[model samples]
Target: DSQKEANGLRTDHWVMDKRHSTYLFFMGVGEYAIVKDKWKNIAVDYYIEKEYEPYAKQIYGNTPEMIEFFSKKLGYDYPWAKYAQISGRDYVSGAMENTTATLHGSDILQKPGQLIDENKWEDTIAHELFHHWFGDLVTAESWSNLTVNESFANYSEYLWNEYKYGKDQADYHQMEDVNHYIHNPSDFKKDLVRFDYASREDVFDLVTYQKGGGILHMLRNYLGDDAFFAGMNDYLKTYEYKNAEAHQLRLSFEKVSGKDLNWFFNQWYFGSGHPKLNYSYTFEPVKKQVTVIVNQSQELPFEFPLTIDVYDNGKPKRQQVWVNAAAKNTFSFDVSKNPDLVNINADGILVADITETKTPEQNLMQFTGSKEFKSRYSALTAIKDQVGKNPAATKLLSAALKDPYFRVRQKALELMDLSNADQLKALGADVEKLASNDPKTLVQGAAIAALAKTKDKKYLSVFEKGVNAVSNSVKANSVAAVLAVDPSKANTLADKIDLEGASDELLSQMLPIIVKNKVTSEMSNIAPLVAFYPFLKFQNPELGKSAEEGYNWIMTSDNLKATESVTKILGQAKGQMGENPQVKMMISQMLKDGLTKKMELLKQNPQKASSINPQIDAINKAIENFK
Candidate 1:
């Protein structure tokens, strides 16, 4: 209770069993407003800052539902006396699962409309909450086996997404995770359960969080739903409040499936990298068969068990085959007729980078007729590489624009050509429709941004509507689109942006537009030039480039006052911008160019150049001092 006692102060004491690790224990006391709720018989407390007290419902109100969902799903009850979450303004990471108490970053405390984009963090909450079971209760035996905890917690994000949203949402998240791991320059072949380490912190990478989660997801798919969940329940029951290694998890699944998981565990957990494959298929009409040749080109080979689907006359015939660890592997399937298309890894059973050498006609069959989302995605990628004015590619992309999956539509929009008016005229209706009516905010944002590439005025109305979108990304894209269609209106659109609350992304996009329109005078009234001028040293290359252009425009303006403002910003940012070579080079070039222009004017009108000598000398001094 918050009531004061005879001691002139209120005291609240809470305790939990000593089953959790030392790192899992947490406590905090401050001027906080406690929001209370319940799940079954367990009490839940959401401790939030007094300023964010009213938003407690929007931030942590769903704790009970998540607890109930996880409890029922894991075949376990709430393990602690009370489940409490505290929103800390100074918290570093997203959130930490501390036995009975979880600490959330202040980003979770959103007010009213802020919940529109901010509520997308429900997955993060789900991730930390799942650690209560995977990390707090059944912990990793050592830092080397961190994947045992982080991977399972990451997988829980997909589980909740699949359970509440749908398989499509879960699949999208899986693909995103795969993309992050694959695109990283680091080696993917490291063993997830190895003792080799640089430090404990090295285990907290994408390999442990994303790639590990992906492997677990694949294992679940391989074991089937019933067996997988049964094995998980057994694993949790056996290791409650205890630390476990990766092999123990393998043993649990092996016991449930009654099969040796040596190939699965050794290749995935102990293996270093995913497969990089190049494949081609041949259809022999006389023999009525399809032959697929796959080549493994990575440092180490991977054994891939994949489903191959052959499409003939719009009908799919599925076959499963294993590709051994060989440089070259071949598989032939007997069919009644020549196959129109062949899909390898149609079920997405393996994580690998696959390239297909198929004709547009063959790919269109999978693009339009394949039942599996992976098959369709692969077909889209194959066709996306060959995107052009080709009628077949255009038709396939147009068809893909209407796909039920947002990712497919997003990819199509990305690959679609809007280089000229004719192309936009052909695909404009679909693109405009998606920009205006797509249910997914990301897809709509992509469509809206694609308009900026066209630079055609026909889609001005679409861009105008998108400017008021709920998503900041969509709004940023809309601003660019408006400027592209009508450069004169950049200042008007930029003026409406809430510069104080604007995200770096929105500011980055708007900055370039404002520079191109030469609207420094209009922007100076909204926000101080110095506040944005330092973006010349921004970490993002694009933001730095835009800021450089903005700086150059202000320096080159005919208005002497604007040019003087540039000098002041350069002076203010001298020491900070010195470390960045790009910013220094840009400033050096601008000063050199400005000094040359002033000298040229001096040859024509000696009196004006004499009057501007002080400004010229200052520019020269700033350039000389460039680090």
Candidate 2:
């Protein structure tokens, strides 16, 4: 409520819900432009910068739909007076669930051109909103049981994708989430819910978020959707506006389903490591049966459901069996003929590392016959390295380029050997078709990049067309493609494009192009490329290496404009790095080393020293200010 004071000023009174956690409290003060929206009768608003006002709805328009969907799915009405999302400059986290108000990073703001391709922040929006139920209404009692809050929010991303897009998109997202935990070997031995953590922050790693979500998915599959959702409704209703632990959640599920979930919860929630299986199969033609063997190499054996797909004469027959608590288990299935393919974990429900022995021909059969996305994806991954060496492998990859799922198509493009003239010549038309006509912007970008590797002048028109594409990814790849085909257009393209909000993929592609061509005309546009080095170095080492190459080139360049732009970026960055002294000191040391190197090079080449002296002085000033 707002009231006018005697001095002709307005004062606003704010009230929050009585039953919220202290951590969920927030107050934002800024010159923000509020975009007014509503869901049913409740107020919904977006607070963002004035420059991004026009694109506010474009970024957050689907919020109301998401709210309605989550409420209906959970069988609970939204329990807040209003919903508001505010974008903060240099936000510490991607987003936070602050009761009815959510805080997000300024990167959520995008231009019309960028949104035309995709709103990259949609998943994050869904995540924080879902937390209003999982994290706010029903809070986790302790940090050790954080899955009651975070894992549900993480799974919300998959649920939203499955609802808005299709299962293929959702499965692809789940695959990425599972891989996030699988690739982090250090976190593998940590239990999902442990009381032995040294710090509260230690419990917020991938195991809690990604692995926890995967475990929930397994539970959902085990219980079936009807019972799973019913159990979820029971849990939320019983614990509304209250704190609960992991065991309470399991008890709620048991209350609804009338089954002992001790095994599921104990093995998954308390277990330390995932099952690592080595699978082998043998066929006994005399008895028309196939014997499949599974060996668990981990310390403890896990009891779980496993799906096996047996193929005979290009036909698949699926069988579901339970793996007991034994290190080794063997199962035999009667078949009509010699088995063509024996695929374990055919549905890919389990979050485990699997090594299966299959021939290239059998994998091709599995790829063609299996209906699950993971099955086809695993088949493609197994045969990706043999694309140029084996004719069957090359043909399978060629067929995969036209797969129904966009990620499958994108993966095929990523695995293609563009340097192999024989492979490129054979599949050139198919790849060019995908580049021009594929519905998915990411797939189209990958196809354009694949065609660019050939360096054929005829495809210059394709790259030129892609330059005007709506997707920043396609545009970035197209610009790099132009540089690869003809180096003369580097300066012109560099000056025209803005790199301020470019994706990491875009930056990774263009940074090398900028350094290779010595394109210094648009130093302001390239400043983001240099400023992004500190953050990117830890997140992605390969991209960090590319950004480092660009940074080093700017520091040592003879161009005065390049040196001035970099130093200005560094001096401004020091102020923002106050909270992160390690990054601040790293930047300070980098500037000092760059200055020392530039002075040494100037002394050796005296003839060019006069022209480069101004650049050296600018670096020295930046280093002094950075300290």
All candidates' TM-scores? 0.79, 0.87
- Identify the leading candidate in terms of lDDT: 2
How many backbone overlaps does candidate 1 show?
4
The lDDT values for all models are 0.75, 0.85
**Pick by TM-score: which candidate is best?**
2
Runs in model 1 deviating more than 4 A are 1-10, 29-37, 49-62, 107-118, 284-286, 381-385, 452-462, 498-507, 514-545, 549-627
Q: Scored by Cα lDDT, where does model 1 land? A: 0.75
Residue 126 deviation, candidate 1, in Å? Answer: 1.2
lDDT of 2: 0.85
What TM-score does structure 1 among the candidates reach?
A: 0.79
